[model samples]
Target: MVQFLNENGEFAVASKEHEIYAQFIRDLRESDFLKFYRDMARIRRFDNEATALQRQGQMGLWVPAVGQEGAQIGSGHAVGPNDNIFPSYREHGVAITHGVDLMSIIKMFRGVNHGGWNPYEKKFHLYAIVLGAQTLHAAGYAMGVNFEGKVATGNPEIDEAVITYFGDGATAEGDISEALLMAATTNAPLVFFCQNNQWAISSAVETQTKVPLYRRGEGFGVPGIRVDGNDVLACYAVTKKHMDDARNGLGPYLIEALTYRIGAHTTSDDPSKYRDAEQVAYWQARDPIIRFEKFLRSQGIGQDFFDEVQAAGDQLAAEIRETTFALPEPELELIFDHVYSEPHPLIEEQRAWLRGFEESLGGHTPTDDGENKVDYGGSR
Candidate 1:
């Protein structure tokens, strides 16, 4: 495995042979390390709180990103503000790093919004639930950037690159294959970031492919590298190099982050049925937050710093809980509002029919609390 910080939190000595990969971390400032620690810790706290909320029936479903924080936060920090990110549904850590409102994501799981935030404003695309679909979207967006003459502009601020996140399961989808072809043939400035998080809803990585996931990228004519995804330093170094290459008009690159899915696939999943307890314990020993915490302490960071971050995380959780409960459910009629930019006869006819049907069944009435209460039996 490619690792800079070992499991014991000690920095590994780099030989002359691996200097190219090691150089990405050689110039790190003290603040950079602290930021990485802070981001990872905050996301893990959010993940835990969200999972608890789901168990408490506050959310419809929740995807826990506990173990993979190193991969997501490291890669998230590597990209500049101009770069666009396309994320699969479980990229809450990456979203947090990009300054996405945590409540917006909470609202999504609460089933109040289709996507809770504006994508263009954050340079982070909405979460794509359909597997592997975002890869094609990312490729297309990157191609558009190329067509707009954003590449080779000699201006880092204007030269944009696209990064798409997916899991080991998504690699099996035809959309990912198509995306690879599109990116390779067009030479689009894109990066295919695959977090090979051990299990795709109980189907092990062994079942997905015979060879390593990164090797598949090589077959598609894009250079691929596998990194120790549990090590934030290694993930940061590798991703930073590839993202820079893509922005420089070097076409697409692939990174297979070898991490483990420490939690259930989602709140609805039961990993106990398929996976063994031993496997979970092994990965738990390699917890990214714990490892990163050790590294920070070794650098003279004290308990006070950690305590401050923990308190901040606690405040964020409280805010998310408050906002989630306050979010109002959208009315049935509002769904048709954004279906078309201009008036459409078909939409208008459907909306009218639905309204009339509701009226015939004794339309919803306002309750004492100002909520619309629909009576299934009859009109109030």
Candidate 2:
């Protein structure tokens, strides 16, 4: 695995094979490190707040990306402005690296919005709940980029690529294989990033695949590499190189980030049911945020900066909680509003059925003109 930082937060390149990846971060200033720390801390705080909200009956569900912050934030920052990102449900850190609002994610879990952000504006696509499905969407988009002569355009601003994020479990899905085949066959400008978070819900990653996941793409004609997902610097450098290569028309590539899922898969899951305390403790010691903090301290960062980050995180959590509590109950008609870009007979029929069903329940039904028509069971 490619690792630039050890568990003790010390700088130790793992091997000569990945030593070259370190050069990508050679020019990073102290400010860059501060930004990285700030973003990681922010996303982690958001995750904690979201989880609390879910437990308190404020949101329906929450996917915690606590342990995977290094992989998500590092790779997210590596992405270029013109690049496209297709994220799985647990990429809150990646969303932060882009311009995605934390409230948009909160709204999604609140069941009031379906990924409120605009993908075109931020280049960050909606969260994909289905396992491994975003790979195909990313492949298709990369092919479109190739067709439009976007890759290898010499102009850095015009050249583009696609990066799709999925977990270790998603590798077993056929959609991932099909996407790999498509990208390889077409030489699409895409990078497949798989965060091997050790567990797919209750099932450990060991049972999911026999071979190293990065090598899984080799048979499909796409080369692969494995990086120390817990090391932020390594993750950033590896993703940066591959994404840059993809933009230069190097075709599809796969990066397997070996990290751990410290929290439960989602708010609904219970990790204690399957995982033991010892394993959890082992990973906690290598917590990404804590390790990154060590590195920052070694660089002479003081307590004041840490204190400021803590204050900012606390303020953000408070704001998110307040906003979530104030979120209005969504209208019943919201489910049918964006089912399609254009009006369809089937959707119209479904809408009418819902309207009638609401009326039968002695409830007010929303009208097209934004008015609520109260049904009196024909008593009036």
TM-score leader: 2
- Backbone clash tally for model 1? 0
For candidate 2, which ten residues in a row score worst on lDDT? Answer: 371-380
Off by over 4 Å in 2: 349-380
**For residues 1-380, what per-residue lDDT tens digits would candidate 1 score against the true structure?**
56788887888845564566688888888889989988998898899999988989989999998899999999998888899999999999899789998888888888877884889999999999999999999999999999998986889988989999999998999999899999999999999999999899989988888889998777778889888898998888888888888889999999999999999999999999999999999999998878989988998999999999989999978887787778787676665677977666666566666666676688743222432233333221
What TM-score does each of the candidates earn? 0.92, 0.93
What is each predicted model's overall lDDT from 0 to 1? 0.87, 0.91
Clashing pairs in 2: none
Q: Residue 86's C-alpha lDDT in candidate 1?
A: 98
What is the per-residue lDDT of model 2 for residues 93-192, given as tens digits with 9 covering 90 to 100?
9999997988888898888988867988889999998999999999999999999999998999899999999999999999999999999999999999
Q: Which candidate number maximizes lDDT?
A: 2
Tell how far residue 33 is off in model 1, in angstroms.
Answer: 1.5
